[model samples]
Target: MGENINFNIVLFEPEIPQNTGNIGRTCVLTNCKLHLIKPLGFSLDEKQVRRAGLDYWKDVDVEIHESFEELRKKYKDGVFYFCTTKGKKYHTDVKYNRGDFLVFGKESAGLPDEVRNSDPDRCIRVPMINTTDRSLNLSNTVAIIAYEALRQVEFPNMK
Candidate 1:
C-alpha cells in the first residue's frame, strides 16, 4: 500500500483490551490506521474491547501483524516514530507527515530496550511532572501523540 492512510498507529504487543479498544476508537475518529502486533493480551472478539470501542469498533480500520519485524519488512520505506519513556525529546518536537507510523509500546514494560534505543533520535515521549510515578495510560499516550501529529498536518480528512 502506498500512502493509503493518513497515519498509522502501531501497538506493539499491547496487553490491555480496553486500552487497545480505546486506541482503536481513536484511530477511527482520527482517520488513522490501527496496527496490532502479535501476542495480544486479549482476543479481538472479546466483549471488553467492543464495549470500550462502542459501536464504532466495527468501523475501525485495523490490521493484525504477526510481528513488528513483519510490519517493518512490509513497509520498508515507511517513516516510523517510536514512543517511549526513554526518549529524550517530547513528541511535539517532531514534524509528522502523512503515512508516518507512530509506534507505541505495551502497557507494562513498554517498548523493549533494543527498539527504544535503536533510534534514539526517532524516539519521543510525553511530558510528565513525576518521572518515577506511573506513566500515562496506553490509550491516553496514543491519543496525545496521534492528535499532535494530526494537528501538525492540520487534521486532514477530519473535521
Candidate 2:
C-alpha cells in the first residue's frame, strides 16, 4: 500500500462504543484505517470510549463516512469483503490483499440485505458451532478476522 495503512476496517453503523473502541485499538496496532459509516450508536469522544481502554484513540486513523457509497466513491479501487453470519464462504477461504476493505455490519442487524447480497462471492463468515446462538461479540469477530487478514499479509508492519 502506498500509504501507511495496511488494510481498511469498515463498520456499517456500529452500535456499541466499547466494541468500536476495541476495534480502534486494533486498527492502531495493525496500521489499518477505520471507517465508520454514519448513524453510529455511541460517541467517539474519549470519555465514553475509554470504558473499552481506548486511551490511544487519537492515534487511530479513523474516518467518519456519511454512507457506504461515499466510502466506495472515495476508495474506488478498494476490494471489499462483506462479513456476515449469512455469508457463503468462510473468512479464511478468501485471500486478503493489503489495503482491502473488510466491511462489517452493526451489532444487532448485520449488513442490510442489499449490501451483503450485492456481492455473494465477497461475503464471508467465521466458523461457528451453531447458527442459533448469538454470533460472536462484535469486537471479537473483528479481531478474529482482522488478525487472520494480518496473518495472511505477514502482519504488515506489526512485529
Q: RMSD for each model, in Å, please?
A: 1.1, 1.4
Cα lDDT, model 2, residue 95? 99
| Clash pairs detected, candidate 1 | none
lDDT, model 1: 0.90
Q: TM-score for every candidate vs. truth?
A: 0.96, 0.94
What ranges in model 2 sit over 4 Å off? none
lDDT of all the models against the reference?
A: 0.90, 0.88
Strongest candidate by TM-score: 1
1-159: candidate 1 lDDT, tens digit per residue: 526577999999999999988998998898899999999998999999999999989999998999888999998888889998878889999999989999999998999987777678999999987667579999999999999998999988788
- Report the lDDT of model 1 for residue 39: 92
Local accuracy of candidate 2 as per-residue lDDT tens digits, 78-107: 799999999989999999988899999999
Ten residues in sequence with the least summed lDDT for candidate 2: 46-55
